[model samples]
Target: MRLLLVEDDPMIGEAVLELLRGERYAVDWVRDGDMADTALRSTAYDLVLLDLGLPRRDGLDVLRALRARRDRTPVLIATARDAVAQRVQGLDAGADDYVLKPYALDELLARIRALLRRAAGRAEPVYEHQGVSIDTVTREVRVHGQPVVLSAREWAVLEALLARPGRVLSRAQLEDKLYAWKDGISSNAVEVYIHGLRKKLGNELIQNVRGVGYLVPPA
Candidate 1:
């Protein structure tokens, strides 16, 4: 999935960027709050990693503005704001969860997973539709009770589609979920990955909607 990371610290931002990239997420990071606001205004993201202490605009204000616009994109507050009052304020401002600085990366990832799962209205960590099973935590995929290996891009496309079965996602929508601002995506990247997935899994899995886009129909 795609994410926006709003962090000003160079070291922290670099580390988190690498971590998220390693996890196969398309992440765009902006150092200042203004840049974060601008990015939020222009694009749609699956999640936002926000820091309260920010330049130009405070992270809280940025979040307030986002809520004012009625954007329900999940926001995870990761900052040094460790005080109880500050945490309450962030929750009140619309943050889905909070993680303190110097936090364990594993815990952060777990929190992110939980938020994403909740946003998708799923209580289980594993996503299953039509005998295709995906374990988000283990990064494992199984088709019809057997194991199946998928390349990173293929997995991204598959997960994006299977996140909500019966929903149609156009090419542009899939591209947005798979690419960040700096990532160079090929013209036929989605088709390539979809083809790869179809070859590995069954051809019946990911159906095209004639002139529309792709969909994972409900079982």
Candidate 2:
């Protein structure tokens, strides 16, 4: 999953970024609300971990602006204000979930998972198709009841494919998900990862269209 963490505190921001990245999430963090707004408007993220106390625009204004633009990306508010009214205000302003500051990392991860599930219109983190199962929360995959170990990049490639089964995904699209905007991507990196997944999951699992990109055939 990809996340945009909007936080200004260096200590908290670095901690959250490292923790989430360790959990296999591609995270882009911004210290101010202007950068957050730009990222929200420019990128496609699975979720946003927004800190309510922000520099420049404040988190409430950020949430309000996001809703005003009709951007439906799920947001989990992270704030030091633990009052009931404050939580209500965040939710009312369009936050999908709330996590008070000084929170447990596990709880924050849980909220992120919950919000992502809600965004995907699912109630669970496990994704199943064609006898292959992907545990989004665990970052595990199984095929034909056997565990399949994949490199981080390979796993990322497969998850992107599974996210939209039967729909052809261009190499550029896959690259976008695998890397941040500033990261350099090899032209054949997608092919390399696709080849790796095909070898692991069976060649029939993913199909290559001559002119289009790749697709995971519907079960």
Candidate 3:
């Protein structure tokens, strides 16, 4: 999934970015709230990891602006503020989840997964359609009970499709999800990954809607 990480602390930001990228998420990191706001407004992200204390503009204001524009992208607030009132305010400001600083990485990852699943309207960690299963927690894929290995790019495409089963996603949309802002993507990258996924999973798993794009049909 594509994510925007709004943080100013160098150590924390780098750590979080590395961890998320290790999980195969396309992440764009920004240090200031103004950049975060601009990125949130211009790009489509599956989730946002926002820090309340920011430069130029506060993260809460950025989130409020996002909601004001009817952009309901899920946001998880990560800040040093541990007070009950601060947590409540963050939620009231539209944060889907909150993680106080000095948190366990595992807990933060779990929260991120939860938020992503909730945003996709799924309550389960494992996504199963037909005979194929994807374990969001383990980042594993199985076809008919047999484990299948896929490249990082291929996995990104599959995750995007599975996130919204039966919903068509254009090539452009898939591309956006597969690449970070600074990453270079080839013109045929999405097609290549799609073809590779079909080979590893099965042709019938993902369907091309001709002019529309691709989707994983409900089983």
Candidate 4:
């Protein structure tokens, strides 16, 4: 899963990044609210970790802007202030959850998991599609009840395709979803991953629409 982390403090940002990456989450970290806004608007992220004290713009502004635009991506506010009024304000401003400073890494992770689960509208983290099953939270995949190992990029490609079954996802769209802006995309990277998936899963699972893109089941 992908998450956006908006934090200005280097130490805290690094700590959070390490923890989330350890859990197999692809996270994009930004130092200011403006960058956070840009990333949130451009990227399809599962959740966001927002810091109230941000540069360029206040965190509340970022939260309000996203909500005003009808972006339903879940956001968890991380702030040093733990006052009831502040918490209420953050929640009212569209934060899905709040984590106070000096919190345990475990607690932060738990909150992130909860927000993602709520955003996905499911308590279970597994996504089942016929003979294939994917644990979105754990980044684990199984084919026909057996484990199927996939590289990070392969898993990302699979995730994007599985997210919208039956829809013909263009190579550009898949590229946007699978890789971050900083990561350079190859010309036939999407095709390569698709071929790999077909070889592993089954040729009948994904279909090419001639000159267009690819389509998965829900057919």
**Per-prediction TM-score to the true structure, in the order listed:** 0.98, 0.93, 0.98, 0.86
C-alpha lDDT score of every prediction, in listed order = 0.94, 0.86, 0.93, 0.83
Native-to-model Cα distance after best TM-score fit, residue 9 in candidate 2, in Å: 0.5
Ranking according to TM-score, highest score first: 1, 3, 2, 4
lDDT of 4 by residue, 100-154 (tens): 9989998898888777767645577777786887886667889999888887777
Among all windows of 10 consecutive residues in model 3, the one with the lowest summed lDDT is 157-166
For model 2, what is the alpha-carbon lDDT of residue 130? 89
2 versus 4: better lDDT goes to: 2
lDDT tens digits, residues 10-30, model 1? Answer: 999999999998888999999
lDDT of 2 at 3: 81
User: Quick one: RMSD of model 4?
Assistant: 2.4
Lowest lDDT 10-residue stretch of candidate 2: 175-184
lDDT of model 4 at position 104 = 92
Candidate number with the higher TM-score (1 or 2): 1
Q: What would the per-residue lDDT of candidate 3 be over residues 1-219, giving only the tens digit for each residue?
A: 999999999999999999999999999999999999889878999999999999999989999999999998999999999999989999998889999988899999999999999999999999998889899999999999999999988998998899888899999999899899899989988999999999999899899999999999876
* Clash number for candidate 2: 0
